[model samples]
Each structure stands twice: as structure tokens, then as C-alpha cells.
Target chain A: MTYGLFSKFPAQPGKGDDLADFLLEAAELLERDPACIQYVVSGSDEPDVVWVFEVWTDQAAHDASSEPEDIRTLIQRAMPLIAGTPEQTQLVIHGGKGLPS
Target chain B: MTYGLFSKFPAQPGKGDDLADFLLEAAELLERDPACIQYVVSGSDEPDVVWVFEVWTDQAAHDASSEPEDIRTLIQRAMPLIAGTPEQTQLVIHGGKGLPS
Candidate 1:
């Protein structure tokens, strides 16, 4: 089954752009990983919030994606910019446009 | 620039599956729309919540999507199954895999 996740990152005051930059960097990293189907980083109308919509080959692939040292280092760098605990909605993708049928 | 939206639909208790089905039907309807880039519907960990992640060629394309009679009628059918007002997060998509570069 295809795994999906919608996550919200609330940046520290005036740090929204910083957080988005970090995620865009992550998107670049994931681009090389075949297991990553989509890693779309977006900015919401809420200035302090950044959202990431991810579709992976499966749950295990998503779990292993964060284990790389580079990714871990990036996460560490991103932590200080976060204002609160991130929120995530785990999902089962039903498929649509842009997804592999 | 690409347009994106992440929306949450809270279904009445026991209507989760029904709402998901309706959204899947919408997905089918949208498959014929050239402006609809991605319209992914998902069932989340929250049993009563359905999430939709959409990407369009532009904001105007997205806004015009529901103007069609078929889509408007589908929305009306979906409303009764919903438990409360839906929530939407408007987005400006930067770029990612599976999206036009």
C-alpha cells in the first residue's frame, strides 16, 4: 500500500521562511531516493506554518528515509526554528492524478 | 506557479468510509479535467477525518474546478455526510517530484 503523510511545521516567530528553506533542502535530498514518490513542500496562508505532503512507496520506506546522517543533521539544524511540536496525519493514499496507478 | 490546498473533512461517526467513497468519486470526475494536476484523497489515522491534497496548474484553475455542475452537485452530496465545517490550508507550491518543473 502507498503511504502518505501530511505534516505541519509551526516555525518560531519570523522564522517561517527559514523552516521552509530547510524543508526544501530535504526535498532535494529525497529526490534521489526512489522510495519517495512525492515530497511537496508548501507555504500556507498562515505565515508561521509550513506544510509538507509526502507520498512514499510504503511505511517502511518512509521510516528509513530519516535514518541517513545527512538527513539527521538537517533535522537538528531545523529544530531551533520550530515553534511547537509538529503535527502529522498518517494516511493511506487512494490514488488520483499524478500518482502511479 | 502551481497552486495547492490541503483540506480536512470530518465525517459524522460511521460515515468516514462513505465520505472517502464520495471523494474517490470526485477523483474520477476530476480525471478528465486538464487543469487538475493532482487531487489526492486519503484516509487518515483519525477514523473520522478525510484529507485531500490538491495541486493545480494555478489558483484560477483550482477555483474554477468546482464551477462545473457535476462537481457542484457532488459537493452537495458530500455535505450531508460531513460532521462539521471542513478546514482548508491554502498553499503556494514551490516544486517537487511528480510536479511539472
Candidate 2:
């Protein structure tokens, strides 16, 4: 089954662009992970918020990706710019256009 | 600029499959709209929750889509199956692989 993760990050005041840049760079790292199906980072209309939508081959793949040193470094880099704790939800994808069945 | 919408729907009790069916059908309808770039509906690990990730050509394109009779009908059909009010976030996409520049 496809594993999904949706997360919301509200940047600290005036840090939206910084947050977006961090995420876009993070996305590039994710792109090289064979298990990652889609990892889209988007800025919200609210200006201070960013959204992350991720799809992985399975829950294990997602869990394994997080253990990488590069990903951990990115997470640490983004921590200070975040306004508060992120809101995250885990999902089990039924079907989607981008996923390989 | 690309417009994005992320919504979460928690189904009432055993209505998950029913809700997923409704949204999957809705995806088919959305596919016919030229302005819709991506409309993916997926089930979650919680079983009762569903997530919708949408990307459009622009805000006006998204707004115009809501005015269509077919979309209105789909909304009406989906309203009851939803357990609570959906959490919706509007986004101004910075960049994503699937989006056309």
C-alpha cells in the first residue's frame, strides 16, 4: 500500500520565503529516494504557511527515509524557521494519478 | 500562478468506503475540467479520514470550476457523507513538478 503524509508548517513572521526555500531544497533530496513517489512543497495563500504532500511506497519506506543523515539535517535546519509545531497526518493511499500500481 | 487546495474529510462511522467512492467519482468529474491540474483523492491510515490534494491553473480557474453544474452536483452528493466540516487550506503554489510554468 502507498503511504502518504500531509503536513502543515506555519513559518515564523517574515520567514515564509526562507521556509519555502528550505523545503524546495529538501524536495530535491527526496527526489533521489527511489521509494518517494511524490514530495510536493507548496506555499499557501496565507503567506506564512507551507504545505507538504508526500507519497511513499509504504510506511517502512517513509520511516527509512527519515533515518537518513541528509534528511535529518534538513529537518534540523527547518526547525528554527517554523512558527510552531507542525500538524501532520498519516495516510494510506487508495489510488492516485502519480502512484505506480 | 498555480492554485492549490488541500482538504481533509473525516467520514462518519462506517461511511469511509462510501465517502471514498464519492470522491473517486468526483475525481473523474474534475478530470474533464481543463483548468484542473491534479485532483487526487486518497484514503488514510485512520480509515475514517480522506485527503484531497488539488492543483489548478489559477485562482480564477478554481473559482470558475465551482460554478459548474456538475461540480455543484458532486458537492451536494458529498456533503452528507462527510462527518464534520472539512479543513481546507488555500495555497499559492511556488513550484511543483507536475505544474506547468
Q: Give lDDT tens digits, candidate 2, residues A1-101.
A: 78888888989999988998898888788778888877778887677788888888898998888788998999899899999988998877776433454
TM-score of chain A of each: 0.96, 0.90
Top candidate on TM-score is 1
Task: Give the residue spans of candidate 1 off by over 4 A.
Answer: none
Q: Report lDDT per candidate.
A: 0.90, 0.80
Query: After aligning candidate 2 to the native by TM-score, how far in Å is the CA of B56 from where it should be?
Result: 1.0
| Candidate 2, B1-101: lDDT as tens digits | 78888888889888988898888787777767878877777886677788888888898988888677887888898788899988898877776433344
Q: After superposition, how far is residue B99 of candidate 2 from its true place, in Å?
A: 4.9
lDDT of 1 by residue, B1-101 (tens): 78998889999999988998899899889999888889998997789888899999899999889898999999999999999988998899877676756
The Cα RMSD in angstroms, rounded to one decimal, for candidate 1 relative to the true structure is 1.7
Q: Give the candidate number with the greatest DockQ.
A: 1
Best by lDDT: 1
Chain B TM-score, one value per candidate, order as shown:
0.93, 0.87
Candidate 2 local Cα displacement, residue B34, angstroms: 3.3
